[model samples]
Target: MGAMSHPHHPGELAAPDPVRLLAVRDTPLSLDEVFAAVGDDAAGGTALFVGTVRDHDGGADVAGLGYSAHPSAEAELRRVAQKVVDDFPVRALAAVHRVGELAVGDLAVVVAVSCPHRAEAFAACRRLIDDLKSEVPIWKHQNFADGTEEWVGA
Candidate 1:
């Protein structure tokens, strides 16, 4: 038997090539690469958001955080990115999430979106990161200053 293709949603055009880059890497993320990916002549505005590990979370002093991801993390990230593209007038998009251990000031994730207007770019960029955090199969192991550790979003 042959595989069956899913039908498109109402008013859905073919999935546009809005994603310029999407990835999950063990090394540090590059802000330059993310910004470059969303460089488009048609776009009048570009917005970028970078999430970094901080010294505290929920009132606890965090020494550092170690990120771990399931094998499907990248695929889930793409799915989230696609949703952003489908919902926005995105000219281009890029997102990268870092894995492995990171210090308080290390960059954990970077997302960028470009659109014809600044408002659209800002909204799309926000959606990309919010959805990515809620939907992706990545967990954070936080080490506290008092020698305690906890895994978040596991």
Candidate 2:
């Protein structure tokens, strides 16, 4: 429908090139704010993933968690997010991961991927989170119900 559409590609198929990356902290994020920068009328599909701080992990009752990150974390996150979009044909991408002290059920991270089809959105979302966990400088500290706390991936 838009200039990005492929004439020969299936009607449901999406173009294999993405344009932007929007990433930030998880606290009180504005979905409208992040996607506003990346939205394209040409895009028909938008996929979003929100990672929340759960109450438990590995059978541990997590009461709270703390996270710390390098000062350059956001910049690096942007770079990596964009790279994933470029490598995967993501139409629009966003990633938000929080730092500092956080309570259980607080949002830990958020990632959104938009493309011409649902598959790219799903794929990109998965990869975005996977890459973030592996590559981003952000770290987490876990607090258990027993008042035990430990730094994770420091």
Candidate 3:
């Protein structure tokens, strides 16, 4: 048989696209912007995640860090967000990642998701952040206090 197709059940409507914002920017990330992007009146709950640059990693004191992204990074982020929306009853979704040099405690990424219930919103938000970290073509260059450096997720 040729390619098999799965069809929607009778009276079942397809889900509307819920992704509102997706960006990889060289400026600071704003939690308020991300949270606002996912605002949905029909949603019973909204979950948000913020990733920040820390002072230490792998037993080393971090001095600072910088992030760089490939040209395709934004497209890959869209793919990851769409996957989350397809798996959950997402009413709205938004994600933003920061590039360029960043100091400790600076926001690295922010993601938010809204759904009909709290659990779905939380789960979808978590999945969106985790997948964005692992699957996107963004790399980090971390500098340590000891004059050493390392690259992660390159």
Candidate 4:
């Protein structure tokens, strides 16, 4: 589907659809929250994407990491998720991002998208995660044994 231009809103862009969006502390989030936001009577297919921190990255022997976000990160994340919903046939959607100190194998982000069709739901779910990683203001900090840290964009 072609990307439609969302009418601009004063002080921000238009947000036509956002079942849920949040930025929370680095901890295990409630799966119930995700399910609630992406649940709808009309949806027959639901897709979920959970992004986790791995023990290593690019062959780096990293110990752990942290994530920081600008104050407007949550709003931006909402916008992105909403856009996916608007562009596709998504019936409901939810995006949650974790910040602060994190350990290996922790959940970093979770994106759930539901739609009437399985293909659209799957496609929208992938797009939601890819765009979140590329466009969101969230950052990742990688720590090594040498006490060095590196901050990278999400």
**Per-residue alpha-carbon lDDT of candidate 3 for residues 1-154, written as tens digits (9 for 90 to 100):** 7965669432132137689999999988888899899887778889999999999999999999999999999999999999998888888999999999999999999999988888988999999999999999999999999999999998
Give me the runs in candidate 1 sitting further than 4 Å from their true place. 1-16
Ranking by TM-score: 3, 1, 4, 2
Q: TM-scores for all candidates? A: 0.88, 0.79, 0.90, 0.81
Q: Where does candidate 1 clash, by residue pair? A: none
Task: Give each model's whole-structure lDDT.
Answer: 0.90, 0.72, 0.90, 0.77
Q: In terms of TM-score, how similar is model 1 to the real structure?
A: 0.88
Per-residue CA lDDT of model 4 for 7-92, tens digit only, reads 73221321245465455555676667887888876777889988877877776777888889888888888778767966887777
- Tens digit of lDDT per residue, candidate 1, span 2-99? 96676843223322587989999999899999999999877888999999999999899999999999999999999999898889888889999999
Q: Which wins on lDDT, candidate 3 or candidate 4?
A: 3
Q: Rank the candidates by lDDT, best first.
A: 3, 1, 4, 2
Model 2 per-residue lDDT at 47: 75
Top candidate on TM-score is: 3
Error of 4 at 65 (Å): 0.7
Model 3: how far is 32 from its true place, Å? 0.8
